[model samples]
Target: MDTRDLGCGYDFEVENSGHVFEVKGLSGDNGGVLFTDKEWSIASEKQEDYHLVLVKECFSNDPVVEVYSNSHRKFNPKKQITTVINVNWSISTSDLNYTEIN
Candidate 1:
């Protein structure tokens, strides 16, 4: 089932097998894929239950598909730090309240 929109960390899940998958699509056979902190954490927790599906040359007619179960055993992932900033605007009730409108 497609779960990418749910933000559960994984992209897809196998209904009966109880397997979760994260898919990485690459334009070419040799490329890199980055996982968010949440995704990495989920993968680590799921261990053997988690799977990574790599689609190399994904847009090409002949795409290569590779499935790696227990990705931790197959590859070592690096951690990257990204800075995020949130800007919010707020107004007090008093500011919007006026006794008379001109």
Candidate 2:
């Protein structure tokens, strides 16, 4: 994975898959995720290869993580452009994909 570490929204890139992932987290209360317009645009361009990794209660040891693979499709269920700079997405608990991480 590669860190962006500067301007241009989105966090890291997964080498070789042409897949880039934006990390998002909730406290089990906030209940949703947000992406910047630029970030979503980038993901949109990448289509089914982009990803969103959301963690519930991120500070906890047993946090619940949901991987939105091919986020363009997964996010389609609740994707909405909030403004010129932000895009809001609602994620259903049932839509989560769990990938085993070693």
Candidate 3:
């Protein structure tokens, strides 16, 4: 079943096997894959039941999919530090000049 829209952390789930898969698409044959905090957490918790499906050359005519089970143990993932900037501006209506447009 497709569960990506539900934000459950994984993309697809096998009903019979109860296994979850997270898919990553790349334009090139090989590259690094980054998972969100929630996804990483779920992958760690799911253990062998979690699968990381990497789709290579997704944009090309031919794409190849490689499935990795328990990827949390197969490879070490480094933490990616992200900087978030929040900008807020408060403008009073009195500071603005009104122009009439037809």
Which one is best on TM-score?
3
Model 2 lDDT at residue 98: 54
Give the alpha carbon lDDT tens digit for every residue of 39-85 in model 3.
Answer: 99999899999999999999999999999999888889889889999
Candidate 1, residues 58-100, lDDT tens digits: the string is 9999999999998766779877788889999987788779545
Model 2 TM-score relative to the real fold: 0.65
Ranking the candidates on TM-score from highest down gives 3, 1, 2
lDDT of each: 0.90, 0.74, 0.92
Which regions of candidate 1 fall more than 4 Å away from where they truly are?
A: 86-102
Better of 1 and 2 by TM-score: 1
- RMSD per model, one decimal: 2.6, 19.8, 2.9
Q: What tens digits encode model 2's per-residue C-alpha lDDT throughout 1-102?
A: 557676556688767868777899887735867776787787778877778888888887789878777776666545575546777997666555554446
Each candidate's TM vs. the true structure?
0.80, 0.65, 0.82
Scored against the true structure, residue 18 in model 1 reaches a CA lDDT of: 76
Q: Candidate 3: give the clashing pairs.
A: none
